[model samples]
Structure formats: C-alpha cells, structure tokens
Target: MLTIHVVSHTHWDREWYLTFQQFRFRLVELIDQLLALLDADPDYRYFMLDGQAIVLEDYLEVRPERKEDVRRYAQEGRLLIGPWYILPDEFLVSPEATVRNLLIGERVCRRFGPKMRIGYLPDPFGHIGQMPQILRGFDIDAACLWRGVGEAPTELRWRAPDGSEVLLLHLRDSYSNAAWLPADENGFVQGLAELRDSLAPYATTSHVLAMQGTDHTRPRADLPRLLAAADARLEDTRVVHSTLPRYLAAVRDELGERESRLPVISGELRSSQRAHLLPGVLSTRMWIKQRNHACETLLERWAEPFSAIAAHLQPEILNLKPLVDRAWRYLLENHPHDSICGCSVDQVHREMVTRFDWCEQIGEEVTRRSLQAIVQQINATTPAIVVFNPSSSPRTDLVSVEIEPPPEPDQPLLDEAGRIVPYRTLGRRRREFFGMEVDRDGFAFLVAQFGSTGGRVQEQLTFRHAEIAVEEGTAHVHIVVSQREGARPGPFDEALEQAQALLTDESIQHYSVRVVEDEGVTIQFVARDVPPIGYTTYTLRVGATLAVAHAVAHAVAQKPVGATLAVAHDRATLAVAHKPVGATL
Candidate 1:
C-alpha cells in the first residue's frame, strides 16, 4: 500500500516570461483565494509559498493588511515559506553569492517565523559543485532539485566537491508533479491514481510525494474540500493533503526501513535526462558578467575586510556597513536564476543593469572611504601613490594616476625614496572629464611594484582609477609624476598583430621582469610566476640590462595575460585585457 502525500505548492517566478506587474496581478488573485481556502477549510492544513519568502515580500508591498493572516499560517507550520530568498542559478554567480542568497532568504523568512528546513529548489538550470558544502553552512541536510539529475535515481545522496553531502530528491516528473488536479471527488481520485502509478515505480519508499502546482499557478480554490472528498473515497491508501516539509518528514521516517535503498550521486549536476543546463550563460551578457566579476572581487576581496580593519583603526569615521548591506541586497535580488543567467526578457535584464550600477556605486564609495582612512595615517603633505596588491603572490604590475599639470612625457615616475621607475606605457589621456578639479592630460600612470603579492596585499607605492580624494578635495598636490604618450602601434587588435610578429623572431631560454628600485630606472634579470590570481605587474626601465629588455618585449607579445613590456628595436608592445574565451587566467 502507498500513501500519497498531496503536497500543495506554487512555483513563483517573480519576474520572468512576463514582467513583475503582470505576474503580480495573478499573484494578488492567487494569494487572496489561497488565504480564503486556508482560513475557511479546517482540513486545509498545508500550502507551500513557492519555496521562496520573497513572494510574501512582493505580496506585502501591495497588500499590507494580510500580514497577520500570513504570520498565523506560517507560524502554525501550515504554510511553508522560504528555504530560499529566491531560487538562484547556481553557476551564474560566485560561491560567496550562493551563500549570501541563502543567507538573505533565511534572514527574511525568520523575521516572520521559522523557515522550511528543506533546500527546496523547484527550478534552476543547474546546481553548482559546492552547493552541498554551502547548504551545510545553513544546516540544510536535504534538497529537491529537478535539472541535472541525468540518469541518477530520483532519490540519492548527493555530495559536494568539499565532501559535504545532502540527501537529495530529483523530481523525475518535474515540479508540476500533480498540477491541475481536478477539484472534484471523482476527477481527483483519478488524478491520484495516475499520480501514484507515475510515482510508484520511482518511489524509493512507501511514501509517494508529489508537487501540486506549477509556475504561477493559481491556488486551488476548492483544494481542501476536494482533498477531503478524495480521502473519503480512496481506500487502498490514506490520501492526505500535506505540506512539503510534513511529507518529507514522513518520507524520512519511512526511509528508516530496511528495504529502502537510495542511490548516491556526487559532484555538479550540469545535465539531466531531458534538459541540458545551458552552458552558454557563462558568457551571455558578457559586459554585465565582467562588471559582476570585478564588483564581486573588489567588495569581497578588498572592500569588506579593509573596511573592517579600518573601522578598528578609525571606528568613528568609517562605519560603512549600512551602505555595504544596501548594495549587497540589490545584488542578491538580481541573482535569481533567470535574471543573472541573462536568459530573461528584456525588461528583467534592464532592471538588472540598474542594480549593477548601484552595486558599483556602493563598491566605489565604500572602497574609497575605507582606503582613504588607512591612507590618511600614512602621509598628507607629500604626494604619494598607494599600490594595493589583492593577490597573495608577488609580481610587478602597472599602476596609473592623474594629477594637475602632469609630468613631462619622458620624465620617469619616482617612488618615496626618489627612484626613476622604468615604465614602457604610452597613450596619453587628456579627458574632457576631470575629477577633483584636475584637468585632462593631467593623468600619469606608472609601474608600482617588483615582486610584491600581486596587488592583493596593499603595496602603497602608486595608483589610479575612478575619482577618489586621499586628502581634502580640489587641493593642489605636488609629486614628480611620469607622463607617458608615445604610441603609433594602432588599436589593440592591430598592436597585438605587430607584437605577435616581433615575438616570432624572438626566442629566449628563460626571462623575467625583475622589480628593481634604483634612484633612476634600474632593470634586473630575474623571473618568477605571477600571483595565483590577479593582474601580473611587470616593470621596464630605460638603460635596463640587455636580458631584461629582450625578455620584457618577448613576454608582452604573447597570447595570455595582457603584457606591457619595453622590447628591442625601440618597438612599444601593448596588449589590453586579453582573456581568451574561457581561459582561467
């Protein structure tokens, strides 16, 4: 005998095939009818709020008066709210993003009541390799996913790359396991029979589980009455109207039996029986993806920790968490599967651009404030450049800055001890736009480090990008800066062409761009690996050693990380941001 757990649910896509307003019109009707069913029907003891708490947030924005009613049902454990703030496409974002997605969801859900413990994911293109490890962080031990199941069984033990495991259920028939079940005695009985037949073969235990709704499905107006009627008529097994958590609990207890044998599946779920998780999303909307990567790297790797450290240093002046959280929430809201994957309607993506802008703004401001607090204690009078290396390994990289009345074209950039920093960078920027009253052509960029933790650790030697003030705004600053402007190599694609031609004739056994701090441009003959992750800093000095000149030019004219090297025959090499399609470097 099989017990059919008639689990009721709605798979809500906040903004998808239709815009948010269009979806909300139906949501208003659905929730209004749904609460009526739950409130009036004694036997209607269960309803899952689409496995996301954000639905409630959306609904409340329009209908604030129904708060108590929702609180009652959620608190009573009848309406299962979030195990997720929103269902996110696992691979579209970084590991930290996935964690924050779950964290935000849990935070909101717990605000009203206890959240559903199950990691209920009705729809996602694919699951990441590290989900189990992340889910364990939330103490979620069980999950239900559809895509990426492939030949794996409906029930299995799934493990993440980090060896963390979660008991998983793959919805073989998809999330709409029992959608459109007729709200009548005879029809519902037939529906249950067909549902049981479909589920029986795949059922790992005597408990047969089924989801009763699909995307944006309306609440079953007479669900409770029909469920009662079906219960009375069906005799072979108890047909119970239930919530997902209740059904899962029953199934867990049933799994305690000796005959139950769940299979074990491991690693990322990128493929399934019918659906192939779209691999193209990794590169889709590439401009947005690039910005997302930069913002994530800056905020997580630099801004957050640096601010925390700075707060301790100057607690009164640098309390910047409120600004940070606001930005984070905006970013998380856009991480939904359809939104971040860049596969949604034009309207949805348009909204994402605004959110990304907010993220960048907040990141810029927070980074500026945090770094300024630290720089303040360093020096105020002498113009100094602070080169911050975010990577752990040390190598040389170029850093740029803009100052009013910029340096002479050939005059070398200097460090604190007054050394000529050998730089092979050309192309001047005298923009119509200037920051802090600094005029165009006032920008001077130079090489900052030799073999320092490649920009991950703050190496305060030199810098530039965006508008930031180290001291007071618009105040005149004095420092001997290197002004660079000698370029006839054409655009990047063309320059790479010329550099590539120069490289064909060059062959060196071994070469390196060593960091030499001479009072003037000093070049050395040393070589080493760039940091594990980030831009490699390489320096080129005038009157450099013959070995250094040949090595620098040859390396720049390569097909990997963008190289800025001073090579032979007075030829300048320039490669701007060369990342081959999916190259990790």
Candidate 2:
C-alpha cells in the first residue's frame, strides 16, 4: 500500500520584501492559530515550524505568554522546531558559521523539547561540499533539502570530504508541495490522484514526503479532515497527517529493501541542478560579503579562541556566555538565505549591516577583554608585547606586535632579551607618544620569528598591503634597477637601434622623454617613483606635438571630445573622454 505523509508546515521568512514587524504580524497570527489547533483538537497529530528556531524566537517576542504552550506541543513529539536557528544560505557563509548556526539551533530547541533529528535544510540556495561532515559533527546523520538537484532522484547518499556520508533528500519541485491544495472533497480527490501520479517516478519506496504548505503559509486547520476525505476516495493508499522524521524514517525502511535502485550523489549540491538556485547570489553584494568575512575572521580566528583561553585562565568570566550567545544570535540572524546572500531589498540589507555591526562590536569588546587580561600579567623587561598563540595545540609562528616606543623607520626592533629581530612594516599609526623618536607616539609594526616557548618555529607569515598607482584599465611596466642591463651594445648606433626595437612594445620600460613638441613639458616614464595606492593621471594637454599625442594608445581608447585643446605651462593639454558607446575610436 502507498503511504503518503502529508507534513504540515509554513516556510516562514522573518523578513523579505516586508520588514520584520510587518512579517511578524502574519507570523504571530499563524503561530497563535497553529498553537490553538494543536491543543484544541487531539486529532491534529503534528505540525512542523518551518524547520527553524527563528520562528520560535519571533513568536515569543510578541506572544511571550505562549512559551509553554509551544514547548508542551514540542515535548509531545507533535511539533518539530529546529535543525537551524535560521535557515541560512549554504553558499554565502563560512563552514564555521554553519556549525555555529546548528549549535544555536540544537541549544535553543532542546530547551523547548526534542529538536528535529534530520538536518532539515529545506530552503538554502545550495548545499556545500562539507555539509555532511558538519552535520555529522553535530551528530545529525540525515538531511532533507531542496534546490540544486538535477534529474537525480530525491534519495541519495551525499558524501563529505572526510568520507562521512548523509542520507539526503533533494525536494524535486519545492518545499511547498501542496500550495494549491484543494478545499472541497471532489477537488481533493483529483489533487491526490495528480500528486500520486506526479510523484511516481521520483519515488523508489512505498512512501512519499508531501509538503502541505507554501511561503508564509498558515497551518491549514482543516488539513486532517481533507486528507481523511482524500484517503476514502483512494483505493490502496494510506493518507495520514504526519511529520518529516516520521515520513523519512518510513521511506528509509523502504529504500533499505531496494537499495540498488537509488542513486548515490557525491560532492557538493551546485551543478546543472534543476532550478540553478540562482548561483549569481554567491558573488552579489560584494561589500557585504567582504564585511562578513572580516567579522567572521574576528569572531572565529580571534574572539572565540581568545575567549576560550580566557575562560581557561579565569573561571569568573564564564557567566558571559549568555551575552556571547546573544551576539551569536545577531550574527546568525544575518545568515538567512536572503539576508546573508546579499540579494534582499535595500531595507533588509540595511538592517543586516546593522546586525553585523552589533556582532562586530560585541566581538571586539570581548576580544579586548581577553587581550587586556592576557597582557596585564606580562613581566617583560624591555619594550615587548605579550602575545598568545590562540591555538590549543603547541604552535610556533611569526608574531607581530605594535610597541609604544616607536622605532625609527630603519632601526631594528628587538625582544626583551635584546635579540635583534628581523621584520618588515605591516602598518604604522601616526600618533605621537612621550618617548618616541619623531616626537610622536606612533605605533610601529614589528614582525619577527618568535618561538611560543622552547618549541620549533613554523609558519612564518606577515600581512602586507601594497599601494599600486595605475590609471583604471591602464597597463603598467615595472623595471628593476638592480638587474644588470644588457651590455649596452658597445656601438652608439647599435644601442640606439636596440632601444628603438625595445620601445615598440608598450610593456618595454625603455627611457622615453617626449617634450610635447619641446614646449618645456617633459614626460618621463619612471618605474622607480610610484607610491602606494597612488595613480598616474595622463591629462592630455594641447601642444605642438599634436601628431605624437594623437598616436598615443590607451589601455582603453579615450576619445578627445571636440578636441578641447589648450596650453598650460608651455605644455600641450588634451582633454580625453571615456570611450563613448557606438563610437569606433
């Protein structure tokens, strides 16, 4: 007999085109009614809350009194709450962010009741390659997700990098399987038939996971009666109101008998997948992407380890966990499919930026506390900064510290034992201090191969920023002065001929002096004088060398608009314009 588990749910986006408050009004109503139905009617077997915990948070924010009502239902195995704090875009965040998201989900939902056992990521853009390992780390062994599956069957063994595997189900059409579910008995009969027929090919087992809701959907209070009516019209099928775990568990059994019939998909979920899940979103809104990386680095690389070490040293600060969790909540809020994917409306993204700012602020403050605690106990003799390797295991790496007594630009910096440290400038802040060489307290970046203790030195690294000055789209030539020049062709004419031949290539760094018709405006090509982040602007001025100026080739053709010609300081000035559309020049 065919068994169909009609999983009742609502795909809730806390904020999308509408603001959170606007969406909350609908969410509050939905949850209020859903809660009432689950309690008022004993027949309403179960209801799934969008495979997320944010809906719970949003619900509690407005209807704080109904906390137990929701929890009671969850504890009874009649409601599914998590697998995610918020349904995040799988591609836009770091693996650590995913781990933290699941951690928050598991932590919060456990307070209410038993959380959803499966990694029920129904709405992420695409699954990452390492998702199996991540889920397994959280002790979750299976996942049900939609998007990024091409012609493949819904059931597959998705493997991770570490060879760990997950039982994955990629929903074919959508999580909204029955969005246009029929209201009348006759319509419901036809709908069930069409749904059954439609799902036959994708079904390898006697069970099918049926989604009975759409985006921002309500609990469809009379779905149980409708399923009962639809079942009477069917001959051999058993239609029942059920949850995902119940359905997937049954399907898992069916698949076990017919193992070879299903496909095992390896690696990530991005490919010639059905809908493509709109892959462009990965690179969209790069400003947000860059900021996200920055904040994530601060939290994952610095703040977290620093806090862990601090907690190891001081047991008193353990109470800061709730505050840290709040910070993480804010950061995770920014991980929603639309929010962190950076494809939301301007208002939504603006709110996201503020959330990020909040996370960064808390992260910075926490990190500062940790550092202050570490640095305050230093017993160094000379000008040295106490540094800690945040890694748990023994590590010896290049350590950089900004010292108060700024060293001279060329002076070698040393440790407390008077050891001369070889270093390069990473950055310097021009603040004057009382004992500084330049009469200012500017901080100097002193990098060195410092051993953590008596261990081996490994992984020498430095952060360097270069300021290259080039006009947009313009190609540049660099000549190293120290490189021995080709023996200068002993004869003058041979040298001149050789120079002429070399000058033909635009990349050739041969000396070129164009006097602009010798109007006293000399243009020299200098490879040695470029500053960081500086640009060389080629302002064309009208001069006697009209033919020479006209022949100048640009990286991108810049046409002379109306030939605006003038002379400044005995120099030819030519005003060039950006390449105009449909213009050959």
| RMSD to the hidden true structure, all candidates | 14.5, 19.4
Model 2 regions lying over 4 Å from their true place:
257-261, 317-320, 387-402, 405-412, 422-585
Q: What is the C-alpha local distance difference test score of each model?
A: 0.65, 0.65
- Prediction 2 TM-score vs. true: 0.70
lDDT for each residue of candidate 1 in 455-546, tens digit (9 for 90 to 100): 21133322121121223222222221222333111122332233223223333211111111112322221123334332222222233344
Q: State the displacement of the C-alpha of residue 197, model 2, in Å, after optimal TM-score superposition.
A: 0.7
Q: What is the TM-score of each candidate against the true structure?
A: 0.71, 0.70
Give me the candidate number with maximum TM-score: 1
Model 1 C-alpha lDDT versus the unseen true structure: 0.65
* Total clashes in model 1, counting residue pairs 3 or more apart in sequence or in different chains: 17
